[model samples]
Every structure is written in structure tokens, then in C-alpha cells.
Target: MASAFQAKGLQYWVSELAQAVLPILPGSAVEIRRLLEHPDTSLNQIGDLVAQDPVLRLHVLRACNNQFAEKAAGTLSNPHHCVSMLGMDNISALVDSLKPDCGANNRFEPRYLQAIIQSSHAAELALSWLPFRHQGNADQLVLACLLYGVPDWAMWRVASNEARMIDALVQQQRVPVEEAELAVLGCQRAELAKALAQHWHFSDQVCGAIHGAPIPSPAFLMRYARLAQKHSNDAASVRMPNKTEAGLLAHSQGFTVHLSNTLAQQSARSWYSKPTLRCQAIVAAYLDQPLVRILELTKSVALETSRRFAIVGVQSPAEGLLWPQPSAQRRRIKPSQMDAAVTKMASMLGQGSVPAKAPKSATPAPPSQRPDPLNQPRAIGIKSEKLPDGLDHHAIRSAPKPAAKPAAVFPGFVSAEKYADYETLINKLLHQPSAFSSEQEALRSITDCLYRCTELERVVVAVLNPERSKLEAYYAQGCSEAPALQRFTVQLQPPNLFTQLLRQPAATWISRERQQQIEGVIPGQFRQASQCEDFFLMSVFNQQGAYGLFYADRGLTDRIGLSEAEYKIFKSTGAHCSKYLMALQP
Candidate 1:
């Protein structure tokens, strides 16, 4: 009788924690809980969720063992064991913990739930920005950011017109979420997220991370959330109009150039780039609309996109080419989360009617349509995005800006139709552009092609100067489009402080103080922001004699220094640019 009472009392308390914790956390009950209780959930991945408990293993077993209690035919000899012992249904239930609905029972116009959903999605999208930097801790960073807006639910019940603030900020203020978040919420989402994250007894690091997110750290997944909402797909050149603004966000968050471009391009289409899908999906579901219908809504699309991109890889952390993981499976952005967010939106229109864009080959506007973006919320075709030039030149030379991006015409899907043109252009530049008279000419031609094809945001080419044994920037793009920047060059000096590292017969990084010390020793190496932050490297070569390095704007993309995966890309880009430069040499 005493043992039975203990079991009952334990069950009751566990239920209390589940009820209190589930509604407060982000992600579906199935998603967050799996990550929370999953033993296989790495020490690194989902640190925000699992790191909370002093005894996570105990909790994992507890959750799993107790899961089947309600339906168990008989008591197992040793019930308190691993999740594998529980049936899949019970295990999944523990993972898919449902809140006992914090039922206010109030029907809010425009639906308060939708705003809550969108805000959560926006935070998730911010978290989706991890992969590009390839930072080891990227996944944890993402969860921290995704959970940032959950605390604002406290404010949601007070805002009478829930949708009004989000809508007005986007349409009238031209806020692309982060800015609007600043405008409306008065603080970055990271702060709000950290506050709630702390309230829930998440890892102080997670709380620290939410606090640390807008600042810098190599713990990238959370850091990149700062850049989740704003992404532009073009990388061959070195300059972007908003690169400066992006860099500012990065520095404040603590990212270096290494991550900027890598994350930026990766984020362009991947859901990992944003977390909005979950928020929007949840909002849409609560509003009672089909998944497809709500993603088509635009009133909060920018925020939605941000949310989608930020959570790009919350599932699988540390995925590389060597690993086969969910993040690497290459799937379309899932609207699984849209189910709930859509319900919130649907509730606003009593009839459940949503604004959808007209299909192609049909008139976009109806005769009696109000001049509202809301009325035209159907997914707009991503245009051929024209990139304008002539504003900035990179470190090496002055050149015309990459041609302006044509208006973007997005294909409906990521099938061959969407990537074909980019692939075709790359093939042309890769194979046929070798006929230039000199490497310099070859470099120019390649830049022009990359720009016209909208393949690169910036380009840099360097050759080792025999006398200095250093890489010298020969040609560069997307930088100081000013005539002066075109003529500039910085010596990729060998590390004086990193002498031991350089002597190791392999590539390596020295200490930061040493790197800074050695940099001061270079004659022309006075520091100035390159790609919007101090980005100077002491080239350390491995036995392979690899030379030259490239980085994107610190705030604009990911952490700098090329990875093995990108080295292959650089080889191709470098080979083509070298040929271009050789042809132009007098």
C-alpha cells in the first residue's frame, strides 16, 4: 500500500511538470520533448532543453518509464528503464506532451494566438541560421533564438488588436521583423527569449545564450538568429547594399565573417534558415485552415520567413557531408508548424477566407480589390533579383558593380526549374571562359558572368607574391566600388605569433592576442572593417601548400575561414578567376 501510494504521488507530480513546462516551451510537444528526453540527443544539441535538469538521465528514464503506466497490461519486472522499453506510442506521447490548453475561452478578433504563433515562428526562423557557419554549437544557438518570443505571450493577452501591431510595423514601418520587433517589442527577440528561457529553468548558458545571442560567440546556432530574417542569395561578388547593416547585427551578436556568406546562401531557401514555419503553422492551425493556405498569407510573411530560416537545423546538429542527418536530407520547407498559426488567422475571418494571390497567367489584381498587400497574400513569385552595382569595390580593384539583380521570378518549387539556370551559368563559366588573354582578363570576365548570372555576391582572387611568400589580393569584387578600393591590397601575411602552428606542417589558428599582435607587425595592415568588421588572417599553410582565403561580411553571413566543403567551391571559383586575371596581366 505504501509503495503504491509513492507511485501514485510520483505520477501526479510528473504530470504537473509536464503540464506547466509543455505550454511554455517552443516546438511541437513531439519535437521539443523528443529533444528534451532523448538520450541520443547530444550534449551539444538542444542544450536549451535538456541541459536544464541536474539529472537529465534520471528524467529521461522517468518520462519514458512512466509513459506506459496508464495502459500497461502488467507491471514490468523493472519498469523504470530506457525509452526503448516503452511502446512507441507511449514514448512518443511523452515526447509529444500536449498542454491542457490554457483556455482563456475568449475569441480574440484577428486572433491573439496568431500573433503569438507568428512571433514564435519569427524567433524560430532566427534560430534557423546555423548551418552556414558550420559552428559546432549551432543547434543550441538556434533553439535559444526560436524560444525567444515565447515570453511575449504575457503581452499577447493585453494587446486588444493582436494583429494590428505586427501588420502596421511590416506595412507602414517597412520592418522586416527584427527591426519591427525592435519597433514593437522594444528589445531584440533574443532578450525576450532569454527572459522566458530563464523563467523555465533552462541552462543558464541557454539563458546566457539568449542574452549572448545578439552579441558574439562561436556558439553559432543561437548567434545567427540575429541575422535570420534578412537573407539575399548572391555571393560571387564582395559587396551588398545591406551588407553593412547585416555586419552590424553580426558584430553585436559576436559572429565573424567566416559564417556570414555561408549561412546567407544556405539560408536562402532552407527552412533551417528560419523558424517561422513552426510559429506560422501553429497559428494557422489554431485558426483552422489547411497548411497550404496560411503559408500563402503575407501580412506577416517577412517574420514568417525569418522564423522559417532560423530553425533550419534544430533537428540534427553537427551534420557534415560525412553524416547523413535530417538537416542534410534536402527537403522543402515544411509547413508542419503552420497548422496552428493558420487557425489563429482563420478565426479572424469568421468565414475562414484567407487572402491568396492569383495564379500565374491570371490577372494579379481584381477590379474591386482593395490596395492592400493583405488582399494579395498569395505567394509572390520570387523574381530574378537584380543586384545593383557601382557602390563598393572589394580590396583589390575598382570594377562595375555586379549587374543589378533583375526582378526576382521565383519558381514554385526547388525542382530543376529553379536551379537549372544557375547551374547552366556555372557550367558556362567553369568550362568555356578559359580563352581570355590573361589571368586578369579571365578574372574580370568571370566576375561579370557570376554577376550577370546572379551567382556571387563578391569575389576575391589572390596570388602568392614570390618575394614575400604571401598571398596578395589581385582582383576582388563587391567591396569599395569606389576607385580607391579597387586598387587596394592587403598582404595575407604569415603568422609571426603562430610560428609553432605554421611550423606544424598543417593549417591552424594561433591565439587571438597573438593574431592581433602579429597583425600589428605588418606594414600596411592597419585595421579597418573589411566586409563590415575586422577580418584579417595570417595565412598558415598545410603540407599541401594551400594558399589564399576568403570570408564574407561578418554580420552579413557566417564565420570566416574556408571549410573543406567550401575549399572545393573556392578551387573552382579561384581557378576561373585566376585564368581571368592571367589574361588581363600586361
Candidate 2:
């Protein structure tokens, strides 16, 4: 079965796969299917069992919806409703059509298991969000989300070899799954899924979403509005002309399912990955909530989905969240490098008693109380010869400094050619003056230039609040995944770098050398927010004087240094933007 469709087109595979018997169900679903052979099996009892397994529920819904297309257009009810709609004989027939072999050795592949779990999570999220969107067929959308990855699961089972190769390529080489799928299977999974769903007569809601049909539920409408507003400040609400209320309702419902499925699919990757973050941001915008709230909702849904679909030997997104292992950058120290205290502690524990209190000479006097590090008073005596850790301070100070390594480029580093291009674009915009029609456009343009033309990983424009008591992030580039950077704010109650910038239109560069000098006046909150000590700051002023601040920096772990050239461009960009703002000021 796996080899039959090799080197074939999408339509060929769809037509062949749709008619082929489905692979054996997951272990849990297979057990539930076995109960169907019992002569005393009741429809209600079978429905309850089927509802417990996401895969089994999908099979039942697929069968029922295919048989009753009209009824499926609206919200299809629970498993019991689908079971009653399809008599016991039809249910048994559906199970029989599945590949017959089922054994205790049957184990789900990682890709297949992840797809199932992710789809389940997506379905749960759709259902959870259903209450917020009253215009859609809630049940239908949830079903669509649940069955969204049906094609992926089916392909993995029927084409194990190809799927394995694709998975290995994606994981080991970091190649995109779509690219691997195209190379190995001769077509992308999405196109294949759409064709297969259509061939199998799946519900139109699921099929349309896979086919990329636009359904404008409230969430989708909100997503559209957010994107529109992101590009233009005065973006108005999007309206569809000549469409009746019913049509709009149907569109919205379809889009809701589409977006839910999209978001879930991306969840199989790191939650902080670019695709996932973008989807989360869209969801956050739609819900009119913070990104943190959206993250919490998704995590909660993943856990609930894991509980509802308890598949053994399979790790779900919930597990990833609950017990995240350390990253490569945070690997545990090797045992051989254990400190003296750690080694002593281990030896004492092995003896089951504190190794008979140290000898009198070694114990010396009672242990001195350590000063409160955060509030320790400065010593007024001559410098100590030995450090607190008992190291000779003079020897350590005299040791030759380690040779400095060349700075490694940050992940967001722009190439020299790209920087030149950005610089050219900025220069044109500044010289032409008519290139930007609004003050907002000019500000966004400069923010973008700083991000692309310099080594900065993030560039933010924070505007003063109406009361002029604080500065809040108004626009940012390269900050979507960083909630802290997105929420950049600084209070002006006390004198600080930001307050000084606002006092007069001036630019300040907090290089490594300057950080120590301004450390006292630099706001602690800004340091916590930006997570970078060295950054560029300049006041943005119009005819009304300083009203905002321009901030830019390499990211949290940036190894690169801010060059003088980059700082010059940063300041010049701000100057041009300020000039534009003053011209536009009424």
C-alpha cells in the first residue's frame, strides 16, 4: 500500500487512497471497535465508547455526514446523534471497512500521533471559542477542527516509508515538512488532503477550509481588521458587498474552523516559533486580549485535550508544556565538574548523617550570617585581600584577560547589501518627503529601517500617554514573539533616561561603556522590559515638542556590538521622522 502511490500526482493518490481501506484504528479505538462485534451491543453504549476516542468519533462523523450531507451543513450533534442517524448495521460496516489487522504490537508513529493530538487540541480550542462567536455552526466548526488532519494521519499509515523519510528530513535537517513532502510524495500534504476529503465526501465545512475557502466568522473578520490596521492606521471595518446575513454567517463559521485548524497545526512546532506566534497574535487581537491570555488558553486546551484523548506511549503538547526539558543553552553541568560543596553534600547524604560534624579545627567558629545581597551596606574599610569565595583577589586581578572572540551575528542580522538597500530606501523617503502621506507612516517607515538597516533585532516606537506620565509601545518591528518587547513601557514619575530624552529632543546611545555611567538614572523597568542593557534611544518630537521615544537594540543574547555607523543611522532616521512629524502637525 505504501509503495503503490510512489511518484504519483495528488489526484491519483486521492482517488486511490479514498477508496482504499483505512489503516487500523489506534489501540484504544480498535478495542472500542471490537465491542461492536458483540451481539448485545447497543447503539447508545457504542456511541459513548466512540465518543471517547477522537479518531473513532471522526470515523462515525465522516460516515454519518457522508450519508446525510444536508444535515451536516448545520451543526451536527453529539456522537449519539450521529450513531442514531447511522443505524448499528452501518456503524459495523464502517468499522469493517478499516484494515482488519489489529494487535497489541500496534504503535502509532510520532508524526501520526502528534497530528492526532494536535487536531484534538485544535477541536477543543474551537469548541472553547465557540461561545465567543455566536454566528457560526459551533458543532460543525468543531468537527472540522477535529478532522482537519485526517489526511496526514491516513497518509502516514498507508505510506509509512515516505512519511518516515519526510519526518526524518524535517527533524534532522530542519527542512520544512511541506518541502519534504513535496520531494518525497510529489505533492504537498494540503493539496492532497483537500482532494482526498472531497473524494471521501467529507463535510463541506472541513473540505472548504482545506480548499482555502474564506469563511468570515467574527474571528476571521477580526483577523482581517487587525491585518488591515497593522498596515494602515485608519483602516476601517471590512464589509462584504451584496452578501446577505445568512451568507455572511456561513462565511464566518467556515473561517472560524479554518483559523482554528491552522492554529492547531502550527502548535506541533514550538509555541514561540514564528508561525505559531503570528497565529497567537491574530487570536489575541480577535479576542481583544493580551498574548499571555492567548497562550494560557492554548495551554489549557492542550491539557484538556490530552485528558479527553488519553493515548499511551504518545507525548502530547500538554506534556511539552507541563515538563519542558532544558534547551541546549541550559544543559545540566556534568557530574565531574561538581563543586566542593555539592560533592560534600552528596557524601554526607550517602552516609545518612552529616558526616559527624566537621573536626573542631575545620568547623572553626559559628558560621557568619551572610549580608542581604540586595540591601547590603557598602564596606568602608580597606579592600579585602581575599574574595568571599576565598580566592586571592590580587592573583585573580593580575591573571591575563581571556582573548576576546569575534562577535557572532544575531539571528536577526541583516546582510550588508540589505542594509545598503534599506539605507537607500530611507534616504529616498527622507528626501522626497511626499513618499509618506501621514505622520504614522513616516514613523513606521523609520522603525522598519532601524530593524533592517542596522544590526538591531528589535525596534520600537513608544508614544506618551495622554497624561504624559508614561510611554507605551505604539509600533514595533521584530517583536511579535516577544511579549515583553511588545509591551515596552516606561514610567516618567522619577527622572530616568526616558524622562531625560523627553525633556529635550536628543538622542542617547547606551553603549557598553555608557551603560555604567547612566546605570543609576536608567529605569530598572526599561531594562527588565527590553532585556538588553546597550540600546539606542532618541526622542521623537513634532511641533508640540517630545511626544514619543525611538528605541532599538540587538536582542537579549546578542553577541554583536552596536557600531558607530549603525548609531548614526539610527539617530538620522529619528531626525527625519521628527521632521516629518513636525510638518504634518496641525
Candidate 3:
């Protein structure tokens, strides 16, 4: 099946590989397995343990949900309920299943081994350091760190050659790992990992960690752990760049960095069971040692770990590890040598240095005969003739002036009197007994008011289903008889902007600038069907939670700009609708 998918291409094979390896636990999962061995462990205790790690919780819930689909009344909200439903025997079996077969050593490749080692080191660091700063379960942090490199392992399993090529490109070009992966595989590894997590029903927090944008706490810890591991294992000094490279440097100075480094130092100290030369070297690197010294220290630490661990029936720490090294044959190809070779090549080709700057002439030639300045090659180190004193040369040959920007024509703002009138109208609508008779009627009245008062080309009201898991279009106005709004039924799960808005009830003005920023969060189908550039998202809620949302938008070419007054009015309208909705409820 894996080979068949691989033949189809990266998209198919990567997903298949992710699914194949979903149940394969990292080396750190051994610790969790050890805890599950005791018979006295309660469901709550096991739940807590599983919940700490997103992957573990996901595995448990997925198994439980699949096994009890018909019997279960609702979706299992947490690990405790899932474990309770599955029972200890089933839970034990699930844990045992996650353990890699001891007999299957031949299946583990060098890349897989390396990823395991990296994950173990990161998990150790997280377990050691994450607890001191926060009261949350430390085990979850450990699990998150352990699974941080899952994408790398999955990629290697599916496309080893492509994975190696990506690594090489990242090193050679000094580009980001994700960017290099995108160049080679046509998709970011992190995005693939997130997709897999989502597919397997991982918790939102865990999925977000895999995504790594807007870095959540767990993801942040994993990043630091990876950085420390890289520094310790690599022979070359991991030089911290002077300036923060956008999208590259995850941490500058914060609690997360400080805690990660502290944990890293602690993990290093535990390596030898006593404070030794290697331990000091690791600590010094964490303390921000000079780059040259860090290189030396890291090499010593790697050598020590390899020598000590290899003696204890463990694999050599640095065995088969690829580390960037300083070139030893420094004088083999100098800049001078390259220049000399280039000069000899040019001489042999009978080409002289750039034709002697167009021979200077006393008088200017006719425009037609003279070379076009735009077309002519610019001469190096040659200065143009100076203009006569006070004769502005820049102004004489300046480029054409840019066109003026058109004034905003959209009716987004309202005068003080007009705003007062809008407020009065909203109040009147809210107090009207006939309007509040039914939820549908209230929604219709609200949509009608927006259509009449605002410059919106379309307006829609989508009501949450009874399960609160899906939203369906209940009302729409303007644009056409068969409104495009009907196509936008949104699922509350696998959260998008609509779901997020429901979670935090608010009125959002989706300006053109913001629309681009949040394109990923907005439903692609809705974006395509509506073909609207900017829109207003107003979430309606009662004490029970967000029951519906009102969407208003202009056409694709037009912009929707709302002032503070207009925005407040939109909010009040939504609020009034919410009040009427609650009143209609039994």
C-alpha cells in the first residue's frame, strides 16, 4: 500500500506514511509504557498521563471512538472518559500495541534511529525543565517534544532520497527547513505533520504545536529542545546570528527560552551521573560560550557520550551522524587564485576588459546617433558629466509622476446624526414585540436592516446545528435569488475563522488586508463561491454559547471599511438578535 501511494507522488505517499507510523511510538514512550504496567493505575491517572501528550490522547480517543462508535452517546471529550469506556484491558492492549516490535530491528533505518535519538534528547530536556516554570503536567510537554520530529521520520520512511536532498539544500543554501522541504517536496513538512495530526483527531493544542505558527507553549518548548540537541550533537559551532531573521529565530529573550536553556543544562548535567568535563562543556555552551569554544566543547561532549554510551551496550551517540565541519584544505582555492584563473581564461578567449569607456567626445552627438542611455551598458567606476552649478540634473531627467490614489467610495462611515439614527433604528427593532416572535423572523429583520442600511452586496445568517458541530445557512439576502451564501455551511471542528469567532464572540471587519492574512483560516470554498474581497463577521451568542453568526460582504472588487460607530452598530444588532434567540428558547 505504501509503495502504491509513493508511485502516485509525494502528497499521497507522505499521507500514507504518516498513517502507517501514527501508532509507532517514540523511544520516550517507553517511560509512559512503564507507568501503564501497574494494575493499580486508575482511569483518571491514565487519562492524565495520556492527556499530557497530544499524540497519546489522540491514539487513545481514536481507538475508543472507533471501538464504541454505536454505543457512545457523544464524542469523547477527554482521555479519562475514553479510558473509562475502553476499560483497563483495552487500554493496556493499546499501550502494548504502541511499543515497537523488538524483533523488527531490521525495519529501523539510520534516519529513523537519528530521529529517535533527537526526539529522546528533546523529550528529556522538556521533562527536566518544563515543570519548574508551570504547574501543568510535565509529561505532556515531554510527549510534545518527543513527537516534534515525527514529520522528519515520516518523510524518511516515504521518500528517503528526497528527505536527504532537502536536508542538503537547507545546509547548502542556509534556508529554513520548511522552505527547503517546500522546494523539494512541494509541501511544508510541518503542514504535512499538522494535517496528519488533524486526520488522526489530535487535540487542537497538539495540532497547533505541529503547525508551529503562533507558537504555542508546547511547540515553543519543543523548538528549544531541538536547538539544544542540534548544538550538542553537531561538531560545528551553532552560531547564533546577530540579527533575528524573520520566520527563522523562534525565540529572542523570554521565559520560554530561559526555561528551555535551563532544562538543557540540567539534562546535560545528568549525562555522566556526575559533574564532569563533558557536563561542564555542555553547560558552558548553554551559558552562551564563544562560537569557537562552543565548537570545541560540543565535539568533546559528543565524543564523551559516544565513548561512554558505546561501552554500556548502547549505540554510539555520534555514529553515522552528519555534522558540518570546517574545511581543512583552507589554502587550496583562494579568492586570488580564482581571480587569476578567470583572467587567464579571458586572455585565452581574446577578450579585453570592458571596451575603454566610450571614447570621450568634446561635443554631444545627435540623439538618433548617440547610444540610448537605457540600452547602453553602464560603465564601472565612470562618473557622468557634472551639470552646471544650480541646474538641477535630478529634476531635468526625473521619471514620470505616479498616478494619484482614488478616494474611498464605499459607504463604510456614517456622520454623527446618521449614527444616532442607526442606533435609534436598532433600538426600535430590538423592542418590537412582533420582530422577536420567532428566531427566524428576528434574523430576517436583522439581515434586512443590514441590506438596506449598509453597502453590502450580500448578507447571510448561519445557525449552529443542535450538536453545535456544524453551521448551516438559515437566511441570506441581496446579490441574487439563489444566493452564493447557501454554499457556505461550516464545520465547527478543525477550527477556521468562523469557529474561532464563535469561541470568542466578537464583530470582525474582514478588510482586504486582513482577508489575505487570514486566508488559511477562512473556508476556501466560501472564499471562492462568494468571490468577495472583504466582509464583516458578527457572531451571535446567548448564555449557552455562540448559536449563530451574521456575515455581510461587498462584491469582489469593492472594499468594506467600517468606522468605530458603524462597528458598534453592527455589534448591537447581533446582540439584539442574540437576545431574541434566547427568548425563543425553551
- lDDT of candidate 2? 0.64
Question: Where does the lowest 10-residue lDDT sum fall in candidate 3?
Answer: 323-332
Per TM-score, the best of the predicted structures is: 2
Q: What TM-score would each prediction reach against the true structure?
A: 0.25, 0.46, 0.33
Candidate 1, which segments miss by more than 4 Å at Cα? Answer: 1-131, 152-170, 173-188, 213-586
Q: After superposition, how far is residue 70 of candidate 3 from its true place, in Å?
A: 14
Q: What is the C-alpha RMSD of each candidate to the true structure, in Å?
A: 26.6, 22.9, 30.2
When summed lDDT is taken over every stretch of 10 residues in candidate 1, the lowest stretch is 1-10
TM-score of 3: 0.33
How would the candidate models be sorted by TM-score, starting from the highest?
Answer: 2, 3, 1
- Candidate 1 local Cα displacement, residue 228, angstroms: 17
**lDDT-sorted candidate list, best first:** 2, 3, 1
